[model samples]
Target: MILVIDNYDSFTFNLVQYLGELRSDIHVVKNDELSFAEVEALHPTHMVISPGPGLPQKAGMSLKLIEHFYQKFPILGVCLGHQAMAMVFGGSLKQAPTLFHGKTSRIYHEGKGILKNVENPFCAMRYHSWIIDHEKPIHSDIETIAYTEDNIPMAIQHKKYFVFGVQFHPESILTPEGKKILKNFLEISYDKAHPLH
Candidate 1:
């Protein structure tokens, strides 16, 4: 089952529709007004923390839900969703060094986890005015995997958990290969990652 926290109503509604198209077997829960426990009672296997147009990295809203999901399922965050992960941990979000409000011009892909055997040189949708500082230490377990061509953090994953966060909108069609990337994460689990050789 897949759970998506309700944040921005318009964007989220469309994103939910996309997920349904991707996999019918996937179940989606629109968790608005439901307590974290109420949400937990549903027992979601894969969870997505929905993005919002709100302030960057809030301190309180849904911290319990985020912690709960991060501890248990394969979680993905988009836009504000990305900021929440950083802030919930020890990290934070700030006004973009340069505002990326629509689409990023240059993005170079590297590393090989879910992106392995995938093409290099790709672009992704941009919706937020904030960015995650990869150089900063959020959590000891945090590792930067993808970054902007100007040298800014774009994606990251927890060192041990199934927690993953992407600064871009993979659900958007603007991201040329976004859907494929999402599928890869769905199939790849943290258990499959090999220890450093």
Candidate 2:
């Protein structure tokens, strides 16, 4: 199960529909109305935070909730979600190098397993003005997974937790191997479903 937290009608609606096509068992909550009480009650297997229009300071600003759940479950943060994750984890965000309102942007940095095999790391639909920039002294556990030519925090993973984030919306059409990335996330949470020794 995946609890998608956000306030966008298009991204939420499209994600709900897209995940259905990608996998039969995948479940998503289409609204950001998930109260801490609500999320605690449900105890979903995975959580994916979707993108929104405005900056984090002006947007929903659910940092406490983001922090709470991130400690409890594996999370995949997209665009705005990515920024939110960085902020809550002691990172900062600022306006992008330029207003990149396009269908794709190249991730020129190196990556590992989840991002492997993609010819280009271009996400399909993104409309944001801000990007994440980690603080000088970042948490040691967090490893940067993706970045642009100028080196923005495109994706990151904690060494100890199942938590992961991407500054781009992999569910969108422009991402060449988007589904595979999601598959990697699903696989991470799968371990929780069946713990090993």
On the 0 to 100 scale, the lDDT of residue 14 in model 2 is: 65
Q: lDDT at 94 for candidate 1? A: 67
For candidate 1, the C-alpha RMSD (Å) to the true structure equals: 2.8
Spell out the clash pairs found in candidate 1.
Answer: none
Clash pairs of candidate 2?
124-174
Which one is best on TM-score?
A: 1
- Candidate 2 lDDT over 84-146, as tens digits, reads 777777777777777777646677544553565555555544567887765455667677878
Best by lDDT: 1
Give TM per candidate.
0.85, 0.82
- Which segments of model 1 are wrong by more than 4 Å? 25-32, 56-61, 189-197
Candidate 2 has an lDDT of 0.67
